[model samples]
Target: SNQSLLTQLLSGDEKFRIASFPTDLPLNGMGSDAPFEFASKQGLMTVMRHVHLVLSRLYPNRPVFMAGRSQGGVAAILYAQHYEDLAGAIAINPPHPDPELFRFTVQYLEDKANVLADLLHAPGVTLHDRSWEAYKTFTPSFDYPSMRSLSPILTLVSLGDPFNLFPQYAHALKAFTENDAKNQLYILDAGHNLWNRKSTDTYREVINLQAQFMVNQISKVRKAC
Candidate 1:
């Protein structure tokens, strides 16, 4: 679905050797506590470690680029912040860095526990408490300034996202890349997930645009080296 954005990037560029993995979040409507527990700072670190190990083994001394959609986008940004060796990153429609947004999401999941369970086909599922606590500590706002020192990045924000926070996230990224003209904040005319409410043609066009953006950024990184 939305992941096609990443897939398209992989297909669009031959020079880029990218890897994709699941966040293992509980968005499948499977009604499992896994989603809640997996949505934490520790969980993200674990995933990033795995990513680092895999890329280090495969690419050795080569520079690596990271990209993701939504929560995946958040993970990309977080990983880039923690690891300075990355060549760059692309985050599409990432969650706001504000802790309150996470708190609201946790509350909404709790309040709509039954409704989510029914929708996901998990009749007795509820968001786990530990998961909620971990999520609270996963805020990214505190680190944007620090991330500014890392490699170049490109952020894609959809203007019509229902969450209404992605544009703010994009702006935050813009501030982070203020002095660096190579980094960019690209605004698209679509929903939270660009493919979600768009037509097939529009979806393809968006994916193509993202692929081109990634190619350009990677080219810039390559030339500067």
Candidate 2:
């Protein structure tokens, strides 16, 4: 989803490669006897570690553009946070999990028809307990500050999204990230799916802007080198 548009924006002129990590059990449920779920905070760190290894082996010298939708978006930010060498990060409708926003969004969903709880209770929901626990943990008391010193974090969201409530997030996350490197948030007219053809196209435009900025920065750095 991110690659197709990223390529389109470079006028079909840039080279982009994509890889995905297979989902693993929550740490220990599958084979090892170590608890499947470890510290919640460490989850991001674990994923970033894998990304660092992949980049080290695959593109030792080339710049990388990291992008993802939803959870992937969160992972992208986590990756950029750990790996400053990332050229840029583009995340769409990413869940930020701010307490204030989470409180309000959960209320909105419950009032809208218990969609929040229903999703949590869904039979097929993977990591259901962990996800719900995380959801509850994010309810208005947690100090959720946006991570500073990360690569450019561009958040693409939909104003009309009934599911994610990106409208409520723009301010909360932005305020937390204002002092960070080129942090940005853009809103579209569509719903939760940031990759819907129209919404995805709009999201890509923002990615293009960030990519250009990163490219220019890289050029300057290369010249200095």
- What overall lDDT goes with each candidate model? 0.59, 0.56
Q: Write the per-residue lDDT of candidate 1 for residues 1-225, one digit (tens) a residue.
A: 336655555534443455554544432222235535444555666777787778789778665677776556666776766676777777776666656555564565567665754633435655555554554455443344454435556777776654343345456556656755545677776654466443676677666776676566566667887
Off by over 4 Å in 2: 1-39, 113-130, 138-146, 163-167, 198-225
In candidate 1, stretches whose alpha carbon ends up further than 4 angstroms from where it belongs are 1-19, 23-31, 35-43, 59-63, 99-137, 140-142, 165-182, 196-198, 220-225
Lowest-scoring 10 consecutive residues by lDDT in candidate 1?
A: 23-32
Number of backbone-clashing residue pairs for each candidate, in the order shown: 2, 2
Estimate TM-scores for all models: 0.61, 0.64
